[model samples]
Target: MVEVADDRYATGSGASPPLHAPRPEVEVVTAAKRTRRQREAATVITADARCTPVLVRAAIVGKARMPRAALEILAPNGAVIGNVALPNTSADFDLHQRFWLVGDPTPGSVVAIVAEGGRQIILPGSRLRSGPAEGQDWSGVACRMLGWERRVAPTDAPAGFQAVFSSDHPTIDGPGFTKAVRRFRTAAVTIPLVFFGFCFPFLFVIPRLVQSGTSTLSLLVLPVLGGGLMTMWSAHCRREVAAQAELVEGGAARWGKEIAFTQSYWASMRKPSAAWDGPMPAAAV
Candidate 1:
């Protein structure tokens, strides 16, 4: 049972407790093997999806508290790999999950006690269970392990352990937005350039011609055409942005910004049903 210094951690709540010992169900693996981070990630937030209530004892180390009380999980590279949007009504969470682990005691560091397909994993969720879209029914409570105040339990002990996480979804089973992102990448750059290209003629060329007192009527067509094209290009860029948003909406991609949620009313968390725990027998949990 390793221990982390209390000062090394911070969260929405003040000064969390010292780390808890690791769970017996955790999976320990080496970094050399391929990871299961992408596979076990939430594809979509649905009631039918396997829900779990494993305790999460890690300290919240995000840059700031999310608008909806969400705890954004960061990867080793700091790119978002996953997020647990608290059961806030306005938040756009694609999936809700929870986890905890004990391994490294270094404050702010992640311990990979749980593993999936050889990859270390952690559930960064609170049992304030919730989802997007109205009429969304949840298991009633979204639960997450908070604080290091070790609570002695008879059969099941509750302790907050440190298991770090990440967000920013990756492409599933394919070229991971290679084509879509590429197309938009081109449009983002080209559209702006195209608009300015036309502006050059309209601002300079047309103005000079008009000043010369030449029959500006015929040349007026250039500005008109340019203006039309610019309008179309602007529209195209906006549409692309919408399309991108749609693609990542559900669990396809991960977000790095604060997501709004109907202020998650803080509450006590109950035990969650197991969604996924590496190599654990059903009877054990």
Candidate 2:
């Protein structure tokens, strides 16, 4: 009887079979494609509009760190309606930052996030996530990110209208006023210190030198020179204070305008038939 040799058991001159079948060679190309799609989806910006003010969330990823990135909300006509600065991110990681768009975006509008290195991401407004903002603690996040100068609060109006106003009022005890006062006090204190610092050496040295038989007239020149320098420094300090005061005044004016605009905006939103007709008034300015 012709019997075939048991080649399956033979290992001396032939390669042995794998203990288990290879995991049907993982399709690297297909897997890569799937990973790419998932990453693209994850990085997309999503919007939430159930609340009064619209909010947008972006998941930024990659090796680049964009410290100066800004989110720009565009109208359907391509005009920039709102811009929010994003927080800093480290290299080779993902960061999620959200901002409330100043005004509602119409359908077909787009959102773009521009990074410092010219990297920009554009997302269509159609990718909005439908949900209510009632349970979400978005205020806390806004306060942390936008600071007191630009914070939003819920209003007593119906339909859950919200108001965006600055906490830096122009009153005497307000943040803006207090900051200006502090800067003035700093300048007041520094002016005297600088004057004394410049005169200290001459005041003490000249007296001793005069007593030691140095020419009294020559020593007098030193104090006069020190006085001249102190005068120049004082004038410079005064100019600096004036410039700072101008800045404070300008900021106060801006603060007032913002408060007024917000009040008007809120009033308009409260109307039954009123809709966001255009971008924020402040944004236009």
Q: What local distance difference test score does each model get?
A: 0.32, 0.32
Give the alpha carbon lDDT tens digit for every residue of 101-182 in model 1. 2222233333222321212333322322222212112111111111121222344433322111113332111243334433
| Reference-based TM-score, model 2 | 0.22
lDDT of 1 at 248: 34
lDDT (Cα, 0-100) at 213 in candidate 1: 87
Worst 10 residues of 1 by lDDT: 256-265
The best candidate by lDDT is 2
Candidate 1: where is the Cα deviation over 4 Å? 1-176, 211-220, 237-285
